[model samples]
Target: MTTQAEKSQQALILFAHGARDPRWAEPLQRLQQIVSKQVSGDVLVHQAFLELMTPSLPELIAHLVQQQVAAVTVVPIFLGQGGHVRRDLPELITQLSADYPQVRFTLAPAIGEDEQVLKAIADVCIAQL
Candidate 1:
């Protein structure tokens, strides 16, 4: 049973591959904060991990569904579309879609593949030369 307030919430989940070291998630946490501030009211941003961390994708999505978030956009904070991004993520989304029929889920491309991101990396490398 979704409340009227819950029906208006839209969420963005920054999905990343987790590490055993807690410090590894600092950057993503910072990203979540930045995104949260940029978005308008009724939009929420969150972080979820693939492994070696708490609140895996499924868990986060489940919570969001429970909260009655109408839509969710999942952005993979990964460098490339490797096995985890290509194989694992799709499988996870499929299961989540089946579980949360009312909520919409969208997957964004891996962050590194963006032209601006690649150019930034190249600029940094060139600066070191």
Candidate 2:
């Protein structure tokens, strides 16, 4: 009987497909650490890669369940909606939901079109131009 409201107290999990270059993951991990620090609540932050790195989505979700979290939010750290975000992520959520029936989990949209992202890109373009 886990309602959406009850799930709000759960931890958040961000899924990122690791880059071939090791440095690529560093920025995302740093961002995660920053968010974990800034958010004021009983929340847990975790990172999982579709490729490379350790602790895939399933593993992280399993860990969250073991911790008896009220809910788990899976946010895809993707630039845009694609096959992985659109298809694969949904499939993973469905499977995870089935596996952990006691713990509620939610999937957030991809962070593709943020205002800050647009401004950052515009600044880069302006600098180049």
Q: How do the predictions measure up, each by TM-score?
A: 0.91, 0.82
Which tens-of-lDDT digit does each residue in 17-126 have in candidate 2? Answer: 88778888887889899989987667888888887876888888777776678778888888887999999989988998888887787888887656787788789989
For every candidate in turn, the CA RMSD to the true structure comes to 2.4, 4.5
State the lDDT at 81 in candidate 2.
Answer: 79
The lDDT, on a scale of 0 to 1, for candidate 2 is 0.81
Alpha carbon lDDT of residue 37, candidate 1? 91
lDDT of 2 at 125: 87
Question: Which residue segments of model 2 deviate by more than 4 Å?
Answer: 1-9, 124-129
Error of 2 at 74 (Å): 1.3
lDDT of each: 0.91, 0.81
| Weakest ten-residue segment in model 1 by summed lDDT | 2-11
Let me know the TM-score candidate 1 reaches against the reference structure.
0.91
